[model samples]
Target: MSPPLRIALADDQALVRAGLKALLESFGDLVVAIEAADGAELIAALKATPVDVVLSDIRMAGLAGPEAVRCLRRDGDGTPVILLTTFDDSTLLLEAVEAGAQGFLLKDAAPEDLHDAIVAVARGESLLQPVATDPVRARYAYRDQDAPKANFNEREIAILRLLAGGYSNKEIARSIFLAEGTVKNYVSDILDKLGTRDRTRAVLKAITLRVI
Candidate 1:
């Protein structure tokens, strides 16, 4: 039989952490390897033992979620990190994405949604909470409606198209014949103009606004 997906969770609230542990354990194919109360503990736990996926709260004591992600990436750890947040602030989401988080999930997400996200991230897929989807779409829709006289430029439109196609910055650069740094700059500009947080939100917003 295949090995179970080893998992780790980090959250500041003890009750919340326990609840998540219970929910994750309810899945027979997943194993909870460790739990941390904060980002520092989470990093320490990771150093002691590696896991397939790390589900972490974005706001935590010690090192924040984004910082932890940066540390992991800097250390060349391939484990996927999923940021869990209660708020839908676009800035936080964008920062986490720029920090190299593999997935973003809302704290109120359903157990099944969390499970699916974990599985998807474990399998190298990006997962965005469904709840965030519509708001993102709405942000883009508002932009499009407000800009009846003007539309996204060719490069911006191309970037949006590639985003909808699930291309990361590196992939988009390769496909569009642009430097990775240029793609990153465009993504930042896109988020700024569309008023969305992350690439996932940008993609949904682009679709709703018909910008692509």
Candidate 2:
């Protein structure tokens, strides 16, 4: 038989952690390897024991969930993370995903949804709650798909995706085999086409428009 998936739980609230632990344990395929009160504790625990997945709260006392994911990613830890949040903030969702979280779930999600999310995320799938889905769809609903596509070609889309990951122009150039100046020009064109003045805004807009 396959070994149970090890999971780490990180939430500021003791009661919430207890409840989540209980619910997760109810699924025989999952095992809680570590429990932490906040993202800081989670980060520390991660250094000790490798887990199959991390379920973390978005807003914690220190080192919020997204930041923890970012830190882990920076440290070359590719463990899947599922961020939990009380509020369905679109900006937060985007930030969490951009930070390398595999899933974003609301605190009040159904037990089955949580279980399925954990399973899916641990297997390299992504999950975003409906609260984020509606807004994203509504925002893109008015786009004219039949109209001529924006001038962004394949290479520009590749560069924009790297930019969204917070890579520098030099790094992006290295990634796509282009000169730094060429990458800079592409970035400028991307910003102009997306109607954003800066790289951060360009990424956010691209995410909003599902361009990257």
Candidate 3:
């Protein structure tokens, strides 16, 4: 079997970091290969040891999650990040995502959800919880409510639901027992239908448009 995916764990709270490390390792498919108390430590540790995913707190003593994500992207390190927050702050969530975080979750999220978020992000999927999604949808709701919704067939709607669930094309393909390339095509069509090239935005637009 392939080795477990390496995870970089970072939080200012030592107990929180320890708890997260234990919980993540308990999954057997994930391993906490690096641990840091803050973003700077996380960044420096990453230079010495590469990891598949990063689980970090949004607020830290120095070099917060958003800035850290920006630094990672600036340095061309495309490793996915899952930012953990204690409260539902849409602004901070958006900042982290805009800075390049692939996933955002509350610290109190269920263990399975946290695991799924990490795995999804590691696979290059974008997953934003409702705490953030609602604001975006409301603010960017369709301009013309009377405009007919895009003619999305049932199959496309199913795919869009999975997209909203934060499943990557590969995962969606496997779940539906369809070919990955076919799923990619479906995603392309979804984006085309939604009139947005960004998958995350496409999902949001679909919700705002009430198509999915």
Candidate 4:
């Protein structure tokens, strides 16, 4: 049998944390390895025992969720983080994306959605709440006026088009008969040229610029 998914929970509210823990534990293949009431405790737990995923509230005592994510990423920690927030502010969402968080979920997201996000991030896929995506796209839509047209060659354009079509990196590589690493490089170039931080943002910028 496949090993259970090891998860860590971090929130300032004890009751909320416990509720989330109970909800998550109901899934057969998920295990709550640790729980923290604040970001400091969360960091300590991470240092003491690593887990496959960390679900953290965006607003936490001490470090806050985005800062904690930045610290982990800077330390080269590969464990994915799923940020939970109550606010639908696009600024916070963009900050989370830039911090390398694998998933962004609302505080009221369904338990099943949380479970699926954990599973998806564990497998190196990004999971963003569908309702959040539109606002995020809108935030980048106006940049097209100031940004230059992408300087991509035909191959790069092909890759960006696939990305805009909602294809994952691996799927794009396969469709184009290119190595995954090659596709990743192309994506990096696309992001650089488009002045965006991530795949979703890049696609949105491309659409706004009419480049893809």
Tens-digit lDDT track of model 3 for 1-212: 98999999989889989999999999999999999988899999999999999999999998888889999999999999999999888777667767888888888889999998888877767887765456665666576453236478877888888887777888899998899999999999888877786667777678767776
Candidate number of the best lDDT:
3
Write candidate 1's Cα lDDT for 17-111 as tens digits. Answer: 88888889888878889899887898889998989999999999888899999988898886998999999676566667668887887788778
Report, for every candidate in turn, its global Cα lDDT versus the true structure: 0.78, 0.78, 0.84, 0.79
- What candidate 2 gets wrong by more than 4 Å, as runs, is 132-212
Clashing pairs in 4: none
lDDT for residue 105 in candidate 1, whole number 0-100: 75
Q: What is candidate 1's TM-score against the reference?
A: 0.65
The per-residue C-alpha lDDT of model 4 at residue 40 equals 74
lDDT of 4 by residue, 1-212 (tens): 99999999999988998888888888988999989887778878899898999999999877888888888888788788999999877678778877878778888877877888798788876665544345555666565555555466889778877765445678788898999998888888888887777676676566556676
Clashes of each: 0, 0, 0, 0
TM-scores of all candidate predictions against the true structure: 0.65, 0.65, 0.82, 0.70
Q: Which portions of model 4 miss their true places by more than 4 Å?
A: 131-212
Considering only N, C-alpha and C atoms within 3 Å, which residue pairs clash in candidate 3?
none
lDDT (Cα, 0-100) at 19 in candidate 1 = 85
Evaluated with TM-score, which candidate comes out highest? 3
Clashing pairs in 1: none
